[model samples]
Target: MIGQFPPIILASKSPRRQELLKLMGIDFTVVLKEVDESYPSGLNPTEIAVYIAEKKAKAFDESIRNEIVITADTIVSLDGQILGKPETADHAFEMLSALSGRRHDVITGVSLLKGHKLYSFYELSEVFFKPLSAEEINYYIAACQPMDKAGAYGIQEWIGMIAVEKIIGSYSNIVGLPTHRLYRELCRITAQ
Candidate 1:
């Protein structure tokens, strides 16, 4: 699987994304390129995710050789509002409080860039959380330090273990990247 596709350059610093790519048995190089994640005001959840992903991919110019550049963005949308990474502990607590006993959508958009050509797509997963107490939210926030994660929580962390009630769609999407869809898309692109 590693050698099936052209060399891949993953343009992200996310450990979760790195782990997912490794789990897929794909050989790729990690290259971090910071890009503004701001999106148009009217874009929906999935669109915002894909837009940022493609924006990150475009950071690399046409000089790239045979390497395929991969970039991804994940966003948590609750009632059509995006819950981004919390900047402060208070904010994290607020995000967690809003998510209590509610179903939210987690969408991740991925972009694959080869030289000047680009491909992009997105995946969505619905996550339901059991009603959480203020104590539980604060405790989880203190323990997990979810400031770096969207929706102020990691689905693979302690909060997810006790708080997540159920999920529909790809679990990996909620984790960060949609590996199954990514693999299939990579296969399709490499086949050509």
Candidate 2:
């Protein structure tokens, strides 16, 4: 399947995204370019994600040619507020505490750029967490060190194994990329 596509460049530093792309059988190279991730305040989670993803893609404008450049951003939203990567263990605990016994939306926005053409989309997944005790949260934090994950958790980590009660959409989206949607988009773009 990957043989049908053009040369690919994945513009992200995330190991999870890299692993997911590899698992999809898509051959690609990892390229990193620093881009400001901040977005306008009034935008919703989906918009914020897509905006950042497109911003990352634009950074490669000077170097792009026949290669399809892919970039993505994932954000966790609870009650309309975004919970970004936790900067500290204490912050992770706070984010996890607020997420305990609650449902949140994980939105991953993807952008594909080839030359001057750009395509962008977003996928949202609903994740529900069973009520977590302080002990459980503390243990997961100490064991997983979820400081680098959005909402202070990774759907594929120790916290997910014991805490995730249910999910209503793509599991891959919560992990930071929507594989099914991404695959479809890639097929569409590469066919053009």
Candidate 3:
């Protein structure tokens, strides 16, 4: 039987991530800390995501003990451009407009730290949006408050319910964390 893992510390403020972890039956504590999210200019989407997640993991002091510190970064990439959180409503609208009836990649990178050892991995989900109207976008944004979400939208929101026609990878990745892979990795780490 799978047993409980060591004490885990999640370094994220995302309600979705928290809920996902709880849904997975994993016991972990939230430990928020600010880390410089900026990355090098030449990095790809997965690289950028992993870099930031590892950076957040590194923010914890080296004195950390038995607890496993977890950090993650999610990025929405369309074409070759990275779409972060929307700065304003108009920005959200613009992002939604561009994404309408298009396909984009949502990548989430995760890092787990125990003492000085670190394990990092990334998951990519391709999302396909149905043709959406300006009114639909506006209404969804007003109802869901997606300004803080990457890609200006959340896959579990009303917009996702209506606009997301298909998904090619982990649904949890689009939600901010890749739960299945994370659970498997945790099992491996705990077994060690």
Candidate 4:
């Protein structure tokens, strides 16, 4: 790990997050914990993301300490509404249709917990898509069942290869983790 504070623990079960951490060369262990991913009705997308990450961190066993525990949550925002992983193909299609040719935001929240200390932050990226035809959307949908992804799409997938026109922020944020900000934060936390 860059910081060398202690062995890191990942509080999420997301393979995307694990892959990101691995790419960053950060050694970490996994402790899958489920937390209610709810938020206050008025909270914005970034706030909701951070709150969910904190919730996941708190879900860990109380015996956890000393080691740094990293938890993260991601969501898509368009027209002031938050979009999460779809439960079905229909839901995924609906989400993609809503985002077709529109600019949306992807936000990822990270929470670092070490004993009594807790730190949380969020990063946002703006993604714009070209107007996608129904045939194109259907083709991509059939090729990649993105029901498990937010905004019913993955920026690293087939749809992204064609539909995504411009991205105004971190690419990793849309993929799920925001590794640059995460690296900096890890350095700061360990330097303390």
Q: What TM-score does each of the candidates earn?
A: 0.97, 0.98, 0.97, 0.95
State the TM-score for model 1: 0.97
For model 4, residues 1-192, the per-residue Cα lDDT tens digits are 444657899887778889989998888999886577878888888889999989888776385867889998989999889888889887888889999999999999999987757899999999999998888888888999888788889888899999999999999989999999988988888888
Native-referenced Cα lDDT, model 1: 0.92
Each model's total of backbone clashes: 0, 0, 0, 0
lDDT, candidate 3, 1-192, per-residue tens: 664889999999999999999998888899888788999999999999999999999998574799999899999999979999999999999999999999999999999998688999999999999999989999988898898898899989899899999999999999999999998998888788
The local lDDT score (0 to 100) that residue 71 gets in candidate 2 is: 97
Instruction: Indicate which candidate wins on lDDT.
Output: 2
Worst 10 residues of 2 by lDDT: 1-10
* Ten-residue region with minimum lDDT total, candidate 1: 1-10
Candidate scoring better on lDDT of 3 and 4: 3
Better of 2 and 4 by lDDT: 2
- The clash tally of candidate 1 reads 0
Model 4 regions lying over 4 Å from their true place: 1-3
Q: Write the per-residue lDDT of candidate 1 for residues 1-192, one digit (tens) a residue.
A: 444899899898889999988888888899887688888899998899999999999998654888899999999999999999999999999999999999999999999998688999999999999999999999998898999999999999999999999999998889999999999999989888
* Residue pairs in candidate 2 whose N, alpha carbon or C atoms collide under 3 angstroms: none
* Over 4 Å off, model 2: 1-3
Better of 2 and 3 by lDDT: 2
